[model samples]
Target: MAVLFSVIPLLLIALAVYGAVVVLRRSRQVSSAWSSGITAQARCVRSYTTTNRSGDSMVRTTLHHVYEFTTRDGRVIRFDETDGPSTRIEGDIVTVHYLPVRPELATAKVPAPGKLAASTGCALLFLTVFIAFAIFLIVVANSDSMR
Candidate 1:
């Protein structure tokens, strides 16, 4: 039972760290794309929504859009994005930025510095909270063992 408690908190900490890493990496990628990427006009080919039911009455809907753009070299690329602008429907044109060498990593808009900082702060905060919680759990487990 004690081991189970320790394991659970450790797992949570690990997950938190993983989440932080993912967030940081994505931020770096987006930053890089914004700095050294090519701009193109992408046409929305399809707009769709996916509904997920969690329980008897709980439902979650996610919006997805498929866009196709032609690169400068005449190659066409199509990609799907989630939670894009709601006003964007099929046949609408939107601006996208992507690395020439990595066209697959396209983004609809440049990430603002403020938003990037906020996201990084949030991820670090999440990691810090989880680490503290895990340490607290270990302390409690050790105290119980002394009793």
Candidate 2:
């Protein structure tokens, strides 16, 4: 029982660290792309909607947008924006930011600087909480063993 309890907290901390790393890396990639990538105008070609049933039996629909753009080199690429649907129309033009080396890795919009920083901070905060609780657990287990 003690071993299980100890392992659980460690596992949680490990998972938190892994998640934080992934988010930070992604944010870094996007930030770098924005600074070093080529910008072009992409058009919303079409969208697909999916209906899902919520936990309360309410039906909800989500829209996935598909956009296409031509790179600076005149190559065309199409990608689906998984960040949910926007209010854009089929003919609406949107700015696309893509890395020159990896054109497929692109985003229609970049998040605010504060937003990205806040995400990293939130992940680290959760990690701090997990570490604190894990330390508390270890101390209690040690005290119990001594008794």
| RMSD in Å for all candidates | 2.3, 3.7
Query: Least lDDT summed over 10 consecutive residues: which range in candidate 1?
Result: 104-113
Best by TM-score: 1
Tens digits of per-residue lDDT for model 2, 12-119? 778877877887787776777677747889998887788889788799877777889999999898887655446766877888888877777677765467876787
Every model's TM-score: 0.84, 0.72
Q: What is the lDDT, from 0 to 100, of the residue 93 in candidate 1?
A: 89
The clash count of every prediction, one per candidate, is 0, 0
